[model samples]
Target: MGDLANAKNGLNIFLNPLYYGKINDNLKKQIVKVETTKDSAYFERIENEITDELNKRLSGVLEDYAEIKGHVSSFQSLHGTISLNKASSLDMVHGKWATHDDYIADWLSGLKDSIESGRPSMMQKIFKIQRIREYVLLFLERDFYRHYKVRTKDKPQENLWSIWFGSETLFWGLLISPRLIEDNWENKPGRIRKVEFGYWTIGHVLKTGLVDPENNTIYKFRDLNDFLIFYESILKRVSNSIYEKQIFAFYVDYIRKSQNPLLEPLLIPEFRYEGIKQKHKYRLDFTILNCHTGERIGFELSPQSTHMAISGIKSKTQTELNKDLALKWGREMQKRNEYFQQYGITIMTFTDDNLIDMKNCFKAMEYYLSKRKADRQSVDELIQDIISIK
Candidate 1:
């Protein structure tokens, strides 16, 4: 494996059998060889199967998972894979192997429950296992042939101890049968948090990657330090008002305190609007992407000095200045509404009054920082309001 470190914890995905549809012929030949030889040697089997030819085949199939280091975890080591294999294979003899149909039926039940619970991530996990079920059946079939005893004229009951292929199948089954994926999602650094497109507007905006407004180029940051370096560069070189800079200093402190491997608030400076480009289309001063929940919040630093300033006022009449002021105010409100409607961003403004107590202003936004939901009005309150009006 080239750049084996890049594959890292993602070797599980590379080893996923379903993704290698074209390798079915090669896999069938390996199964046949194992069956004829009746060899249960784990490491020997893997080393033999993972030949230069097989690796070439795997390269074509596993490019996506192998090359993408961000998709992998540092937690899963070679030792971990072997440990999982030993544990699962030892237990395989104690339980009856499920028929292919039964296995699929169980997966469908889990899929239904996941969907009803609104867990698309869990559904995806189930689907991955469900797709590779045929490979499991192939392994079972191979075992039946390999363990066949001439004296008994029957398949001898045996535990599967093959590390590479057996472990990968067991891993997929464990992921679906137990709540391993969900457990990792909540408590461990595993899958990169991916937002589905329909879930929120911010999903569509940052779907590709973060856009650097300074250069209008894509910037990929893997860690807090990467983001901080990019942010510091913008502050030193880009033109921002003193108030905005002060607010950003506070934001940096907040990000530092809240930063974690799983959940980090990305404060993108001057996040460009996804709406139609126009003179009125103002980039958000700061857009905080809550990676944990896929929620976006916009911080607008609207100090009266800059927001309400009328340029070339001395060159215009009183009526012209008033008209310009009205237009400017109109555009500001329109931009706020547009952001909310188009990007699902809760735009919070900090005027001079709000900036006077800037710490408290930022504090007020704590509620909208997570998964946002509309508070439902109670029937009792509705009835009371109706009676009071009469």
Candidate 2:
């Protein structure tokens, strides 16, 4: 009974619904239904069965309940710290925490500080779960298909052991769902050729006998370390753009935390201006509006890969033409800058190099805000300046 209790507690922490918030909404809806259902005998039975299997699996890997509780405690502490910080800060300022922008910069800043101070955060746990998920899916897809020939495409009965087991396990259900996988083929002149887009498929597992899609061309891993190396390489390739967006989100979060009624920051605001030729529209990455004075300051992030012509466009044949076009685009960007300056927009640009570190990113923004605060321009004067530019 004690062992069963420990197992239940451990599994709950490991597969908490909160961890799966970023997953598909459909999966979330299904999870809620399962959690809320009261009278379903099948659901209860399936839950108990999954619990028993997971307990048995984890007993082999985890040392004891202490380790599980440690992780759970860390997650709880991190969440509590963020909440406490927000509450305390809002109390100090005697202001309500507004939900208008979905900005929780103060909370995020607290979390980041905790993480940097050697406290555990969701990032570490997320990576651990991702590793476990990969291992489980690989084992199941390979073993189940090879031994029982239970392909998901066969519309396997919901009551079948394999289907029932997968559905009851949260991570398995999230990753192994039929809807999550897609197969693509290219129709060539003589024969159809398989063009890999790094998708998961049972066909690849069964036919090619490959354990992972990422290992198709590379040498197969004989040990855990080798598999981790392969996993990291694939993860890096897929997560670069995601990481860039996360950095942007963190910047927004920092701005939200520093929120003062006197100076409220707006994100990704659209500005309209008439060009010499036609009407032009531009979106600033972030804009700070001084509520007391009504002056606006804009900040733009220009990542080298996305914004700079030297790193962005890459075609051997079009290299010379692209350089010429890039110069033309540069001149247009200059004109936009001139227009913003004419209208008293006080635009500042930061490149990828400037945002390499989170601490540095916040510092740069803080410096800009300070400078803007010191400016003597009035809101009415700025408005008149904008009118004159128009």
Q: Write the per-residue lDDT of candidate 1 for residues 75-156, one digit (tens) a residue.
A: 2332243234333333333322222222222333333444456543311221223122223223323333333332112111
The C-alpha TM-scores of every prediction are 0.38, 0.27
**Which candidate comes out best when scored by lDDT?**
1
Candidate 2 lDDT tens digits, 166-256: 0111101101222212431111231112211101222121222221222212134454334334333432233335433443455445444
In order, candidate lDDTs are 0.42, 0.35
Q: Local error of candidate 2 at 325, Å?
A: 5.9
Question: Relative to the unseen true structure, what is the C-alpha lDDT of residue 310 in candidate 2, on a scale of 0 to 100?
Answer: 52
Q: Report the Cα lDDT for residue 343, model 2.
A: 48
lDDT of 2 at 119: 58
Compared to the true structure, candidate 1 yields what TM-score?
Answer: 0.38
Q: List the residue pairs that clash in candidate 1.
A: none
lDDT of 2 at 241: 53
